[model samples]
Target: MERPELPLPQLHAFVVLAEELHFGHAATRLGIAQPPLSQQIRRLEDKVGYALFTREPGRIGLTPAGRELLPAARHALTDLADGLTAARQVGSGRAGRLRIGFAASVALTVLPGLLRTFRGRFPAVDLDIREMTTAPQLAALREGSIDIGLLREPPAHDTELGFETVLDEPFVAVLSASHPLATQRAVRVEQLANCPFVLLPRTVGPSLYDQITNLCIAAGFTPQVTQHAVEWQTVCALVETGLGVSLAPESIRRIRLKGVAFRRIEPNAARTRVAVAWRKSDSNPLVPRLRAAFDQDPPDGPRRRPNQ
Candidate 1:
């Protein structure tokens, strides 16, 4: 047999009346009339199939069943209060999980500092960080796998998502330390026109890939891509072998391969940007709070290489 549902108001009334052992006093404490408090207790007793109190002329006392249920009832109310507090904390973005997707290369630049400061400010926010390329980050945001993304070359127009550029840096040429170009102060984008190029495949980062290719075209030549590597480290390694030259965000300078040299690209007109993106429809409270953190302490500005 299924028991009838006991209302919270009734349970609360029972606990109060049990504590006071006086209907009038309990009613005073609960901010209710004596009659209503007595009625609430009677209803709760009926649901539990046990008499919860004994009433005699000028006397009131709990029945054994009431004594047995008191501790459990009090514990239940305490747990409910605690649960509500935690829920409110999460609602306010003070405590909750925030899943963040970021590009692998971002780790070489502002990512570490951004995370350190954000953790200090919101220690209770559990950060779920995932390393992914731009396309996967966008896909994750759309499907709700991630709450936010720090990626490069965000789409110029997207109605479903909001993007804010956090870092914009000029392109630098990656050359073999022994290559003749490495001896020059800077290399013109067109100078690399005849050099075999090392680049990441277009499928991995289509927006950035297009940006680089278009920069080359604007310089009056399309690069002859001779090798493909997914990561900047690999691209630098390939460049070190003198297999080809490459163009990368200035931040890639952090990956110091002994055989690889970074040179400022001439014209300096082509640049790549890192942007933070989130779905506009997302209702996560932490989203805006994290956004505020980014705004307050934007990623460390990219370091410039010394004059050659």
Candidate 2:
């Protein structure tokens, strides 16, 4: 046999009638005449193929069928209500996962505070954070796998992806506390010509590699490359052990690596920027909220090329 459709109105009428146990009172609560309420209850019973109520000597009470349906009816209504609310919240950008990509250095600087504040406002948003280099981050943004990127290099103006500089500060030289330059308040880029240098591989970030090499060339010397490390912390660790010296963003000082001292680079040509990148047609509405949180002055205006 074909199942009858359980209309919302019929279920609602049955619920009210079951609760009241009196036709006139239920009809009053439902804002309808008693006769129409009776018809609705009859229709509800027909649909379920069961007697929902029993009447005896001016008294009315539920049959076993009505008692069984009560809880399910209330539960179904509540589920629908909650599901609708969730949909609205997602549409408004108040809830949902936001995939974020970043170079490891920013994790120690603004990233932690930015995430903490964003979460306080939108606790329901899941932050899927990935530590990626500038190149991979740009590719991820283009491929739609990530929503936002925190990068160390400036990206070219592309029609498909938009980029902005969040913080543009001059590079600082990283040295062991025992190194001769450690006592100097500022180290000139030309001063490190003969010193062994530690660096991140070009595959990790080509733009930063280009910036460092170009700065060295402008200073009238080629850097003597001695070592390469994968992460910023490792680079700092190498310097701390007196293995070699390196150039890094001022923000890297936040790591507070022991036995390491950061000195401002002279002439300020070797500079780096902390940038934000996203798809030009990014569908996630939360991007604006994120940009507003981190948008501030870049201590040294904007980072320009080393040659410039």
Candidate 3:
């Protein structure tokens, strides 16, 4: 025999009747007349080909089949209600996972503090974070691999992405403690033009590296790059070994290394502008919460001491 379609109204009537146990009261609770309520239950029982409830003069009780099915029925209805609520929240941007990408540099300074504040404010949101270079971060944002990105500067191809400045970080020079300029209170970009430098991979973004090169040019000579590293820490490590000097965002001071010393660069020639970026056409419900996470102000900026 073919199975019959389940009638939602009949199921609803059965659940109400099971709770109230009295037809009149169940009908009142359902905002329907008693006859219709009874008819609904009878229809449901007929569809199932079994007596769901036993009825005697002025009394009602669930049969064995009804007792066995009640728990599953209630669970189904409750799950349906919860699913609908979650869908509504997703539509309104109140719920869902937010995947975020960040440059290695930004993660060291602003990302940590911002994440703590975001957790406090939006505890329910699931945050997925990935460390990527500016190029890959921009690619991830455009391809929908991530919902947002914390990166340095605006993307070179601006038509596909939207950017908002989150912080402007000044450039600083890092070198081994034994280096001559490390003892200076503050060093000028001009003084380091001839020093062997460690450079970020040109693949990261030409404009960013250009900012450093342009500063050296303005200072009167080109830097002699003795080494290149893909990440800031590796570059800093090379600087610590006395391999050469490097220019990095002032925020890099937050990371402490035994042999390294950080000093401010004079005239602030190359400032790194960190921005929160997203795709122009993509819309993720959790974008605002993710943005708020990066915008939270800390009681103090990352600690930087001239001699530490």
Tens digits of lDDT, candidate 2, 15-104: 888888999999999999999999998988888889989988899999999899888777776777889898888788888789999899
TM-score of 2: 0.84
> In candidate 3, what residue range of length 10 has the lowest lDDT sum?
299-308
Q: How many backbone clashes does candidate 3 have?
A: 0
Candidate number achieving the greatest lDDT relative to the actual structure: 1
Stronger candidate by lDDT (1 vs 3)? 1
Give all candidates' CA lDDT scores: 0.88, 0.83, 0.81
* Candidate 3 Cα errors over 4 Å, as ranges: 1-5, 293-308
TM-scores of the candidates are: 0.87, 0.84, 0.90
Query: Which residue pairs show backbone clashes in model 3?
Result: none
Ranking by TM-score: 3, 1, 2
The ten-residue window of minimal lDDT in model 1 covers: 299-308
- Rank candidates, lDDT, best first: 1, 2, 3
User: CA lDDT of 174 in candidate 3?
Assistant: 93
User: Each model's RMSD to truth, in Å?
Assistant: 4.5, 3.9, 4.7
